[model samples]
Target: MSASSRDRKFPLAIEALALSEAAAPFSLRLGQGEALSLLSEDAQSLSLFCDVLAGFASPTCGKIFIDGQDITSEPPEHRAIVLVSPRDPVFGHLDVAANIALALRAKGAAAQLIDATVKKTLALVGLDAQNGHRADLLTPEQAARLKLARALAGAPSVLVLDGLLNELDLRAASKTRDLVTRLQRALGLTLIHAASSREDALWLGGRIALLDRHALIQCADAATLMERPSDARSASLFGEANLLTGRVLEIEDDVARIHLACGGVVEAMADAELAVDALCILCIRPDRMTPLFGALAAGDDETPPLVATIQSVLHTGEHIRFRLRLADGGEIEMRRPLLQPMRGVTQGALLQLAWQASQAVAFPMKDDL
Candidate 1:
């Protein structure tokens, strides 16, 4: 289905949001109760986007609409958006309960209501045990949770989390992501999580919006974005990809057979039409390419195989990475689980590699290149 149709199904919670900085203008739309992982490696850019969403910064162009209401010009207090930044402040002198209740007090909530809300928010975030402890005495994880609790005190419609999971270890990050997902569903909140790495965005497990040079590059689910990226930049965002320049030789249904400049023929699933002899690029993940042992297996596999000499091997804890040089001097990398048996696989060893057509993506070559 088209993006417009998908957007219609999920009503807009945040629409036409744009922010301008020194680099370029970025714009995006978020659906209700949907979690969007904004991918950007630049800390400043991430901060600017969050600030704009939280009304801490103003956009030079575009408007922000929430629940069909224009809130572009509204102040932070009235936008019903909560921002939990990595640098979120806390009152060192105050206790956990008091810090969580600060927003309620600012909104002129009654003392009794503030206390009730504070208790509930603390318990909801699993921080009730530290209610009476000073804010400064809390650990980094606990402090971060307190900040989230404070943000939730107002029951904001949209939650903007800026690199909250960036500094966390893998296990902790997973737990935090799960907690955020649970809270989003329970509270019916629209969550916008900013991540600096592709793994972090994928770990969040929803829609991902890739931002580069202050521009929104691509927005799609993890699998779709990896399989059918719009451009080289988008394709490279998901880690190392085996990209080769080639020319379309023929088209059969949804597959396009291409002859690579590096001296190999490959077939890839094509999502767009391409003229014969047209230059294009074939992209496939290293892990998708399987290494064939000994002679070609006696099977119905029709994928063209290439022989390469293993140039280097790197052990990466759970996996082993091999750098190989093909007969035509083209270099490629492949990764396999360390647990996988490799009887004769070693540096300087000849290995055959092949991948199915459906596992590769083909994109037309750009004129600029």
Candidate 2:
């Protein structure tokens, strides 16, 4: 089924949007009040995506519908979709209030209406526009907020933010994300946020659209995308996942026992049909694998533990990252909370690592890898 046909029942704010430059075509759909984080590391592709969405550049082919209306040929102004960037064109000489009013004035809004709208927008974004601070003097956070205020002044149903949150540190980014999400909910606006990293995408807390090679590779929430990626590339993009090669030893109900190349057997949740001895890949997040410091206690489950030697340990503020080498010479990484007791763990120390059967995912092995 086509992407557009699958989402017919909902009132879409953006639909069947496809674009192309020198590589594969790009396509996506966004429903009203829904947020989509477009994940792309390449700055050029991200810029082009925003440009086409804002009507700054025409797509080589395909249509763009906003609010169920075809606005593929309409200029940016007529689409009720606003694009706000960190470096958005703002009149540096003008004060915050004037900058906020500029777009409304250009649209021929009444002077009183512009004043009222600008006042409300600035307040909504937590900015004191009456202070008359010049645009050139605003801090990065303030400036970003101003840009959002300006976009809101236009009363758009859709907001396209281009790398605006990428400039801030984690703390500031979290605050900005919260503010944007609240605004999106309060205003009933569809948001298309361009994110540069997996952390940023996860922090944005929305369905993510992974854009690679000028194509929409995958679209899903953070958990689904990380746990059940469509391919190896998508899995790698999530970062810090142990993608291990294994052969199916047996299948019982929804669980499959697999023999890992790393010299251990593990049971994983199996969603796909696999015959005995079929080669596949297992995806397990580092945090999901726990280290059993010593031998198992009496009456413990019969599942054998995975034994490995700790290769290295790094102390991150919140967790300790361990690099371990398996008996078969393969390596894997694991993360343990800082509060977890680390009694006998050290470099070159032998340890038993185990994880729940439901925590692992299996997929058909890709030939490229």
Candidate 3:
């Protein structure tokens, strides 16, 4: 390879990698030395996508690239891509250290090198003290970490994980996530993680490719997806987003004034092309919504607070989630912290809901929504 080719930032690019004939071809670029997460509600699709990346499954019509080289048809042995998944098997006959060393050895790594890498990876995954322990005797957390250690021992070009952390408890998963992130940064490894939930995707923290069922919905940063979702489906994936159908009343720069189908007119930030009187789907996060107290803040009278009765409240320690029934009988949700609870946030209490225009996003109305 030329010096320039070796030094250039080589992104892992996937162009139209379709899992099935009906599943929309998945495409994304995991930038050099950073992590990217494929988020989806479908576990099977996520696994298939990761399998394609790991060269274990064939794409109907697509190409995969690593270090600017097409690896579309490369077999697992030649791809230099490793996958860690819940279904990954452990060699019960092999000891902890031997399990990790096996992959490096397969790559024809020197004995000294394999031994060194195995020891270092064990420490990195917090399994250094268990190097001689039988792999079958490991706890769930240890087994998960061992999987990571084994994958890292080979020093893969791209590491693809299929909800590997989801196999552990909440606390263990959080810790393992942090460890994986640190390892990736320290090694300058290209990481692509598959997550079944938005929280998992958000925690992974690079770029997010959201897949609904099997189709690629949108690929962007967490803030972009949250505050400026491409559609109602994307918005709903995030926390408790309140979506209401509406029509564009006017366009003011990047923000659009919308008249709701339910009964209010509110302003929302429009990141997409929107013309006057166009159909719109308004998205506002429950956390961004507030209950109006005393006199309402002066703004747009057409966007007056909608009167609603709190139907139920769920306290999640950090925040209180409320289910409210609007005047038109439509339900809208509001979530707020306990430190600053609304004056009448209790169940059956009447309240006026308000939210800032900047906190809302407007997407073009679609039948899928």
Q: Pick the TM-score winner.
A: 3
Model 3, global lDDT: 0.81
Q: What TM-score does model 1 achieve against the real structure?
A: 0.83
Q: 235 in model 3: Cα distance from truth in Å?
A: 2.5
C-alpha positional error of residue 49 in candidate 2 after TM-score superposition, expressed in Å: 3.1
* Candidate 2 backbone collisions, by pair: none
List where candidate 1 sits over 4 angstroms from the true fold: 1-28, 41-44, 293-307, 315-318, 326-331, 337-341, 367-369
| Clashing pairs in model 1, backbone N/Cα/C closer than 3 A | none
Model 3 misplacement above 4 A: 1-8, 105-113, 252-254, 293-305, 327-329, 341-343
Question: Candidate 3 has what TM-score?
Answer: 0.87
Total backbone collisions for each predicted model: 0, 0, 0
Per-residue CA lDDT of model 3 for 40-80, tens digit only, reads 76788889888888888898897888777788898988887
Q: Report residue 186 deviation for candidate 1 (angstroms).
A: 2.1
Off by over 4 Å in 2: 1-28, 40-47, 58-60, 87-89, 129-131, 169-171, 197-199, 202-205, 222-240, 273-275, 294-307, 326-331, 367-369
Question: For model 2, how does the per-residue alpha-carbon lDDT over 108-179 read when each residue is reduced to its tens digit?
Answer: 999999989988998899997444999889877777888889999987767889978766777777777888
Question: By summed lDDT, which 10 consecutive residues of candidate 2 come out lowest?
Answer: 296-305
Candidate 2 accuracy as lDDT:
0.77
The alpha-carbon deviation from the true structure for residue 334 of candidate 2, after best TM-score superposition, in angstroms, is 0.5
